[model samples]
Target chain A: DTAVSQTPKYLVTQMGNDKSIKCEQNLGHDTMYWYKQDSKKFLKIMFSYNNKELIINETVPNRFSPKSPDKAHLNLHINSLELGDSAVYFCASSQVGKRQYFGPGTRLTVT
Target chain B: TQLLEQSPQFLSIQEGENLTVYCNSSSVFSSLQWYRQEPGEGPVLLVTVVTGGEVKKLKRLTFQFGDARKDSSLHITAAQPGDTGLYLCAGGDSGGGADGLTFGKGTHLIIQP
Candidate 1:
């Protein structure tokens, strides 16, 4: 069974277009996170939710919003996307005091 | 800002060779983790070292944590073509927000057969 999964493995859209990427986890973890990996392969934390509660909110722009409707799901919604937003977004889940399990990742391309 | 620096941004070696990569930081961390990422996939956790001066081995890969908890090393013996991938090191509790891990730039390893 897939422990962590993400939707729309690839997304290509024009600048200023709005998009959303969905993520789900079946590992029954309490903590879910969003990370962005740039072309340089530098992974940075964007957001984190623990048991459906907002826990970590990085210095991402207000255009990027993360919503966790429940402990099992966390989704990212981007508004007015720009060319600089092109990157791979990854979703991960982890139990308290444990290692994280990552999803395959969603590649977002902004033209 | 807390940062982890990975040495040898890119490496390409023949099969059966050995290589070592380093992850260094100026600030201390509560824990450190190593991950391997293949093409079109997210990083997969390989190991986690928490204690100072701790060492762990998985098969032919050996991991070591510095006594100050500010650095770590990954040594792979008998490299194989299947081992080619990007290796990443991350540190936890380096003020990267709550429960966030600060990741290094990563080392790209290409094992040639």
Candidate 2:
């Protein structure tokens, strides 16, 4: 079984539209995170949630929001998507003091 | 934000060649991790070093954490085609909070047969 899985591996939308990407983990991890990888292959942390509590919110745009209904799920919702947001978004989870396990990533394209 | 900078953003070598990748940072970290990602797949953890001046070995791969806890290195011996992928180093500060890791820009390694 996949440890971390993300839905809609690819998404294409127009600017000013809203979209959501779903993530689920079967590893029973208590912490989940969202990351964005730009074309230059720079991976940056966006948000982190531990046991459904917000732990870290980086300097991401206000249009980006993360919701974790439970410990196993964390979803990212982007409003008024901009062309600059075109990149690969990855979801990851980890047990306390452990290495993170990442999802396959969702490739988002904004026109 | 904590930043991890990786050297030699891109590397291309023939099979059987040896290479070493470095990850450096200004701030100290409580732990450091190395990951390898193939195409269309998530990153796979190669190892984690938690102590200063620590060295860990996995087969032909050697990982070392700097004495200051602000840097790490990954050395691959006799690389093969299978070793071609993106190598990323991430650092975590346990005292900071339970936040996610900070990753380097990543080194794209290409091992040609």
Candidate 3:
């Protein structure tokens, strides 16, 4: 069974369009996170949610929004996507004081 | 500036060679983690070191946390093509594992057979 899963493994959209990537974890973890990996292979944290409560917002742009409906699901919605937003987005989950488990990333391309 | 920095942004080595990847930071962390990611995939956790000066080994991979909790290293023994991937080091603050991690620019390794 997949411990962490993400939908839309590849996304290609035009600039100014809106898109959403969904994530689900079956590990029963209480914490979920969204991360953006740029073309330079730098992974940066965007948002974090613990038990459906927002915990960390890492100076991400307002156009990028993360919503966690429950402990097992976290979704990222991007509005007015820009060319600079083209990158791999990853979803991860972890228990308190434990290592994180990541899902297969969603490669987003904005034209 | 990046909170964590990794040395040797890219490395290509012949199989059976040993190599070491380094991760450094000026700020101290409560815990440090190492991950390996392949193309088109997210990072997979390799190990987590919570205490300073702690060292953990997973098969041919050895991970070491700095005595000041500001640096870490991953050493691979007899590296094979299967070990080729992007290696990342992340730091977590005192908020436990629930907080967002500060990641370093990953080291991309290519092992040749």
Instruction: Name the runs in model 1 displaced over 4 angstroms.
Output: A56-58, B94-98
Q: For candidate 3, list the clashing residue pairs, or say none.
A: none
Proportion of the native interface contacts kept in model 2? 0.76
Alpha carbon lDDT of each predicted model: 0.93, 0.92, 0.91
Off by over 4 Å in 2: none
For candidate 1, the docking band is medium
Model 3 ranges off by over 4 Å? A56-58
Best by the TM-score measure: 2
The sequence of per-residue lDDT tens digits that candidate 3 reaches over residues A1-111 is 999999999999999999999999999988888999999999988888886577656478899988877778999999999999999999998886577889999999999
Considering only N, C-alpha and C atoms within 3 Å, which residue pairs clash in candidate 2?
Answer: none
For candidate 1, write residues B12-90 as lDDT tens digits.
Answer: 9999999999999999988999999999999999999999999999999999999999999999999999999999999
Lowest summed lDDT window (length 10), candidate 3 chain A:
A50-59
Descending-DockQ candidate ranking? 3, 2, 1
DockQ, candidate 2, comes to 0.72
Instruction: For each candidate in turn, give its C-alpha RMSD to the true structure in angstroms.
Output: 1.7, 1.2, 1.5
Per model, kept true contacts as a fraction are: 0.69, 0.76, 0.94
DockQ of each: 0.59, 0.72, 0.80
Query: Which is better, 2 or 3, measured by DockQ?
Result: 3
Between the candidate structures 2 and 3, which one is better when assessed by TM-score? 2
